[model samples]
Target: MKREVRIMNYFPGCDPTEIRMSGNYRYYLSKKGERPLIVIGMNPSLANRKRADLTVRKISKVAMLSGFDGWVMLNVHPIYSTNPKAVKPTVNNKKQLRKNLNFIREHLNKFPDAPVFVAWGKNDGVYILDTGRKMVNDLLKEMGRECYAFKLNKDNTPAHPSRLPYKIMIDAATNMNCIYKLQGS
Candidate 1:
């Protein structure tokens, strides 16, 4: 049996302009605002311009409650996949990775003051995810921008927001004290 995916209007005031996508890749998703909480995640999921997956909603909620007018979600891997294990890098995907990294740099340059939250989990030992995360970390270090997270896992990976408790998430978001500076600064 095949399951159907439903796309709904989770953001009442958001129009299609808030999302940016290219085929299976999502560069970023945002709500209307001058100040947006920028998030870097493992990959895109079911969320898109027209829908709000659980993860997207969680990130947006944390952003909203943290005094940001809106949120912008980017990802280490640009491809949309509910299961990380299913994502593998092909030649085309490698191209996508370069493009994805370029867009990330552009976004960071675009929003110099926006708080960046690195929320990609351990990536379940996926090489591409690990590489992507490391590349982004290098970029962060190069840009000299401080990043934050709810907490780090036992493995020291940034805690993915989905696993974090709502109250903790809000506290971390509001306090903005869980700073995790990349090593080799």
Candidate 2:
């Protein structure tokens, strides 16, 4: 099933063509054209091309405040659904993941050195979420990209971009420290 791309007016100028849903959900990219930040989300929420999802909106705001020229978004899961249950079954979809990695790789190639923001929140202790997390981690390692975790709570997990307070997200931005890396080729 394909995600729908409506023709509604979206704030900050959302164009249907820009939302890449070839393999999965609508990937809302920033117009600044300088992807200085790489945002990794758990998956696509109800947000689509018609409107700027909360995650994209918040991340975009933080990117601007942090002085980043622009930001790009990817997800741990390839399923595009507003409901979490929809993506739960594909926790270990290696085939889909490989396809999605192409998107990630292309983005990394374009923005080779952009700092990574690992914002994939642990999905209620689901087994699939864990598998997805592992795949994302390994992919980053292979790409030789340094990943950072958001200081969302005591655990300092990658904070999920929802209706989180602007100050909270801003503070999490400061907590961006190297949490993942690759040593050898």
Candidate 3:
């Protein structure tokens, strides 16, 4: 399949890059700069190199306001889906999950000093994303890196950027603290 590529005008003259595999799974989306904010979400939506989804746009705003020149968006799951609840993984998806984790690890290593923002949110009380969140946290811990969020749900899950109130999100962007405390630590 021919790859589709386009430059996003989100940063205006700043080159943006995107990586997708087999035409559907997006591994990364980044607006290039010296200092990039790392954001980890639950999964990819319709956002692409050609367009910015609401979440991506919101992240860009928060990142810029928070003193970062650019942002990189990653997901626990790489499959593209607008409704995250609809992404039910099968046995075959386990391989994809491993690949996603490895990609996250490698990319994160490249930005050792960049702050990581977790915004996967509570999976609508279904708890479908608990395992993924734990896996991510484990990886971060093993790597000796920590992540923060604008807000965490009552249950302690990081609040999804798309669902957060603008004022709260903006205020917390530069003043975030670690929200997911490791168990028995």
Candidate 4:
């Protein structure tokens, strides 16, 4: 029997619009042969209105084309709040973070051995590290699977702007068989 892969999609904060503008909205991982579980962020950005329709259309296409199991929207609850001073508010809230992890656990209970957990980050790069760390722990505890977080470079290579930190993350993930694949613009 073929193993079913499920993706839990994660986006920073509560912005439906940001979710739409993200590269994953256009180039879905399922198209690359990986299963995706979409977890959308709650924060809305200025460009959301412009990209909302297109993003929805693309997501719809991916859903039809890839047959996603389902999606969970994080940062949507009223109680979820973030620190403005922090670069990424999503990581700052421990309560919401646990909720997100629970969401992942619920999904993993149904589908086993999925390769990746797709998450979208803010342009500022604030949420990536926290999100990556949480994902790693969540995956290990729930499924014994390792997780990786990759940020794409301008050339679409798996490179981080901060080379040293990126290298450290890559090495760590690699050692655990988790890799963040960077895509170029």
Candidate 1's C-alpha runs over 4 A off are: 1-17, 183-185
- Per the 3 Å backbone cut-off, how many clashing residue pairs does candidate 4 have? 16
Per-residue alpha-carbon lDDT of candidate 4 for residues 38-59, written as tens digits (9 for 90 to 100): 4223222112322232222333
Can you tell me which runs of candidate 3 are displaced by over 4 Å?
A: 1-15, 125-129, 182-185
lDDT of 2: 0.64
lDDT of residue 15 for candidate 1 = 32
- Name the TM-score of candidate 1: 0.89
Task: Report clash pairs, candidate 1.
Answer: none
Worst 10 residues of 3 by lDDT: 1-10
| Most accurate candidate by lDDT | 1
**Model 2 residue 183 lDDT?**
22
What number of clashing residue pairs does each candidate have, in the order they appear? Answer: 0, 0, 0, 16
Query: What tens digits encode model 1's per-residue C-alpha lDDT throughout 128-169?
Result: 777788888889989999999888898777898877887988
Tell me how far the alpha carbon of residue 74 in candidate 2 is from the true structure, in angstroms, after superposition: 0.7
> Tens digits of per-residue lDDT for model 2 on 1-185?
66443323444532222456654544335444564667888776655545666677677667766666666778876666665545555434656666667787788788887878788765776555556667777788887788775545445566576746777666656556535332232
Cα lDDT computed for each candidate against the true fold: 0.81, 0.64, 0.73, 0.34
TM-score of every prediction relative to native: 0.89, 0.75, 0.83, 0.37
